[model samples]
Target: MSCKRLAIIGAGSSGLVTLKHALDRLPGWEIVCFEKGGDTVGCWGNPYPGFISTSTKFTTQFSCYRKWDCEADPASRAKREDFFRGAEYGHYLKDFSGAFGLEKNIRLHATVDRITKVEEGWKLWMGEGTEVFNHVIVCTGLAERPRKVKTHLPVLRSMDELPEGKGIVVVGGGESAADIAHRLAAPELGNRVYLSLKTGIRVSPRYHPIRGVPSDFLRNRLMLSIHRGLRNAIGQKFVEARIRHREKFERAFHANPEGHAKDEAINARRKQWDARLTAAAKDNLFNVFHTKSDEFLDDVAEGRISIIGPPKGDGFREFSEFDGEGIIEIEPDIVCPMIGYTSGLEDLTDGELRVRDFHLGCLHVRHADMFLVGFARPIIGNVPTISEMQAKLVISLIAGNLERPRDLKARHEQERERVEREFPLLNTEALLPVEMFPYCDQLASMLDILPTVRKVGLRRWWKIMRAPASTLHYLDDDYDADAVDSQRVHSPPLITGLLVLIKLIDLVYRRMRRRASSRGSVCPG
Candidate 1:
């Protein structure tokens, strides 16, 4: 194949990985990665105050380029931590670039003002001059603009602006909101932290309820293979029980039982919050995606943070609506709205996450030369891993190693229908939410890298199925086998046995259902 010039926008985790794959796959290709920021990692380099990743270090890392624990190299052990701070993660990305010699290809403090499609290819307008590339990959992530909500209080644009030791109401029930609340409501801070939820959100603890392992450890091939409806239904019950148990445990162990009147006051306050939360989330509990947080729920139970609904009849008309009665007695000095972000991919996407337009959430249906990476939000997993998978798909397409479908529209419709059928409860509107395992598997299947039982053997396949859904498992090379396995959090034998039994029963039921349908379809003799 002839050489091609590739322009990658935004040298974040996504862009860096894309460049890595491009170097590996498209060896002779001319690649230039543009980073508008001064540093390599985009937002992570300048993370919010006291920002810690919700994802564990094991799950948040890039598939191919990641640090490993080595006895000889003590510095590599940082990768074994439970979670990564923003600065630590940024350093890791920088280290990755340096390790791969990718920095020379990356243009820091450079911006691509405009991208236009021409007969030759895509024309990128930079500050100095315009350049045309055979292929362009937009790795600009979702956090383009902070989502704003109508409120009367003094609104904080970002958590970086939040002051210590003040009455604060953090809006939104998302990860950012939860983390901010957890941090600001530290018992030592003496800050009255109140979390306002317009809609009830599902919260996943850092540790699994059953296995006491990282909750993400449960996000394996076997677990994801089960229907999302079933998995979520079971998950909802477990999470509720865990929360209840935490509440009881905290009250018994952490609280002062000597003062009966004081204890009643605390209980009443928590009960009020619980009632408000239960009412707000009444019907749509399963529909909401889980946000991983270790301290937020515990803080709420301990009376460090108060949970409330939107102010009554104050905000915009359509906002103040849920199952609960809106309004609260406490008036916050400052309000931080962590509602989410706009995609900022409007030029090509038209401010919409069209799965049809972006094939497999990477390739452009109309223009194969144009690709979008890191645009998907996984229901459970992180984005960097997903971006790596997408980058591989893009590289495969560009190299002509992967064949494009003759009918893309039909394929898109089929995929859309399949997603709707499998994940009936998902709210697929803005961020193109995907089941990470299935999505990655789809891309891996196209790449012909998906591990099969026959290829890997039954024992290895079982181990892969049981382990955390790391991207390494799909690779033919067992280079990172020890690194990945070292971090494995095994479930109890009884629980594992039960899970296998359930899976077998589900498989049998599916087979019987298919046979019955096939029999019914045949006309009687």
Candidate 2:
């Protein structure tokens, strides 16, 4: 097969940038991008309707042009906490596509149906025609399809259809659920809204408590190092418990003894939820993915909206069987399931790729030409950077520059085990959120943007040893096209040694765990 043409599906953030970089790295190579939406921005195509972006714009925004560097609005420039409206974000993505000159290569409104192996590399069916390319990259972000849980009331999936003078129950703990709850708690809704959480979830404010700075600013290399240090020093469980307790500890800020009678009333309202709804929140306080909330919790405490549902535990049961009084009260004017979307794995393949862990959930070993990007759903942090890093890894692999594990099967088995162990609560359909710091660092190391520890300067190399996490620091406009050419280019000794040491440690750890479990040692259950 001649490696002359490349086909990228989905013109989302990942696909768009992949197209741009491929052009830059592989000049004159024929690359065509298929986007089902008429416009390049996938989620942003109907951006105004998705409510607001939960992630802060500054860090979430990916750019090669540095376009957002100079904001004309004084208020926005001075304060980075304010989020952009959906329309604004859509425009920004469109601008990014234009800045990178990707419009020409993007075939708008093109939907890929299935891909099959071909003598030339792979064959694809897109609508009325068929095409084949040397490589195929799926960049569709995780919005596969909305999971529907049949409720007594008609599930209201759209925000515009929300009616006043009716009770609504929204089931979820992610951005969509929080956004809907906050909006429904408006005076017009008559305070008859409820949110049902199924797992421990964090409801975080847009800005930090003391500094009033955006949370994205704090998500840096230092924060990653701190996270690793805590995980190491006290263990992951302790660190997680501390995080889960953070919200409960913040009660001191709200409970004021010297306040007016109205303050006492608000506090009392908060207490009302103490027995009924706080069960999930208390357990999941720091356990689940954090949902960005500006007013969901405040409204809940003030009796504007009520909370319902038990978290994942012995108390927890399926939603269909749940007969919580809160659900019975509203009877639910409309049930909204804000649970996240799934990756459309079925559409990507007709054979062989059905059920297997694609390299870190991106690369495929059975059919090496297959690549799945923008599928990882991190519980926190923005996704564009993940998309970028994943794309970088994909291109590097395709070019034959990166090395596979000497014992590829062993590595894959270990990775699979780790994923399943780390997230026991997540179902098979749900994409478990990755630990961003190390995942991104591993991708960066693979790209050689930062070399293995032994090859770099002492200080720079030490940082990698600790954790290679930084957002804006690693964006690259160009890359070496010949990176995938060397078959013998194994990873540096540092990377190799680190992997081996980690395996040994994990082996011992798992053995201890098995022993503990056999002895009926306590688990989260």
Which candidate leads in lDDT?
1
Q: Write the per-residue lDDT of candidate 2 for residues 328-352, one digit (tens) a residue.
A: 3235556666775777666577444
Model 2 regions lying over 4 Å from their true place: 1-3, 63-65, 68-82, 158-160, 189-191, 226-286, 310-328, 351-356, 404-406, 428-432, 451-469, 475-525
On TM-score, the leading prediction is 1
As a whole number from 0 to 100, the lDDT of residue 71 in candidate 2 is 21
**Model 2 / residue 258 / CA error / Å:** 21
Q: What 10-residue stretch in candidate 2 is worst by lDDT?
A: 481-490
What lDDT score is found at residue 486 in candidate 2?
16
- Whole-model lDDT, candidate 2? 0.60
